[model samples]
Target: MVLYLQIIWLYLPIGLANIFASLSRHIFPNWDYPLDLGKNYRGQRVLGSHKTWRGLIVGILAAFLFFLAQKYFFNHYQSVRDFSLIDYNSVNILTGFLMGFGAIFGDALKSFFKRQKNIPPGQPWFPFDQLDFVVGGALLSWPLVPVSGVVILVAIVLGLLFHLLFKLIGYLCRVDKTMI
Candidate 1:
């Protein structure tokens, strides 16, 4: 049980990367530089205007900050270290960067596919929208972390649940345009 909790805790930063990216639009309203820079493939936008540089930077930075906080807690609290998946002391910014990049990149990759399918931005893509970051983060962190397949599966499921819960909260609070 403790191990499961630890996995979910460790996965939080990765799972929340898309949320931070979405919130970045509000933080930097004027910086709407699309990552694809108006590029298109097969007569379709490679990645819609929503996948901006600002969101990517902010998401990665947020994840890095979150990792630092986790490291600080791990150093100061035995309980944190006891539940950690990695030695916080040994992990560096690269870990956070990979996790964040993987997540945001995953979302953008999904957006590419979503565009090909003619799905509009901000529209939910069902489980793909929820699981993309989980799979991306887990795959990217696989070489760096010592996580088991079970932990990865659990994290994916937890990510999906958390995404749905947060979407519902955002909708109820009138902060989001839609709820998945």
Candidate 2:
């Protein structure tokens, strides 16, 4: 149980980034401008209309703040400090930024390939949508924290499960325009 939680805790920054990216788009419509700047690659949108600069920036900031909250909690509560998967006492700017920004970039990479395959934006792309952020977060955060294969596999599996569960909830509640 401890190991499972440690793995989940380690990956929460990326997961929150994914969720907050969607929330940022919904909350701040004015800021939702494309990172691609109406550009094209091979006569098609490079990353599609949905990949926005605001989402990336907001996602990164949200994850960093979440990390800061965790740091504060661990610092104040010495007993539960063992639950920390990474060094929460020290500033973890690089790890937070990598996990958060990497998640959006990961989604953009999938969108890139999805466009090449002629799949429209906001349409479901199965496991890729779920696993992309996890892969991106883990890969980019490797320099900051070299995790074991077991932890990586666990994080991927948990991410997939949570993604499916959240999408189901969103669909049932009629949350339209979501990238689930």
Candidate 3:
């Protein structure tokens, strides 16, 4: 149970990255610079207008801030340190940046596939939508903080559950039009 908690704590930034990216749409409505710059592959949009520079920036920034807070907690709170998977003291901001970048990149990559499949943006893609960031964050951070396969699997499960919970909350709060 403690190990599971530790994994959840460690991967929280990845979850936050997606949340921040979604929130960025509302926060910076005017700054809609698509990552793909309106390019097309074959016929479809490369990544759609939803994947924007602002979302990436805010997502990364959110993860970075959360990491800094984690570091502070590691230094000041025994409970936080107890749940930590890595020694927060030894890690730096780059860890958080990589996590955020990896997550956003993963989502963007998924978006590319979604475009290829003719699945419109904001449409649910089932498990892929929930697990892309988790896999991306884990793969990108593998060299920096290697963990067992079990840990990775647990992270995926937790991420999926959390994504669904957040989506339901968004729907109930009227922030989103649908729940996935």
Candidate 1: misplaced stretches above 4 Å?
none
Clashes of 1: 0
What TM-score would you give candidate 3 relative to the actual structure? 0.93
CA deviation > 4 Å runs, candidate 2: 176-180
Model 2 weakest 10-residue run by lDDT:
84-93
1-180 per-residue lDDT for model 1 (tens digits): 887688878877796677788889889999889999999998899999999999999988888788778888999999888778888887665787888888998888899999999999888899898888888877787777777888888888888888899889989999878898
Each candidate structure's TM-score, on Cα atoms with residue i matched to residue i, is 0.93, 0.91, 0.93
What tens digits encode model 3's per-residue C-alpha lDDT throughout 1-180?
888788888988888998899889788889989999999997999999999999999998998788788888999999887778888887766888888888999999999999999999989999898888988877787666657788888888888888899889999999877798
lDDT of each: 0.85, 0.82, 0.87
Predicted candidate 2 versus true structure: per-residue lDDT over 23-120, tens digit per residue: 88778989968988989888889888888988898888887787777777878987658777666655456788888988888888998988888888
- Global Cα RMSD, each model: 1.4, 2.0, 1.4
Q: What lDDT is reached at residue 34 by model 2?
A: 91
How high is the lDDT of residue 4 in model 2? 80
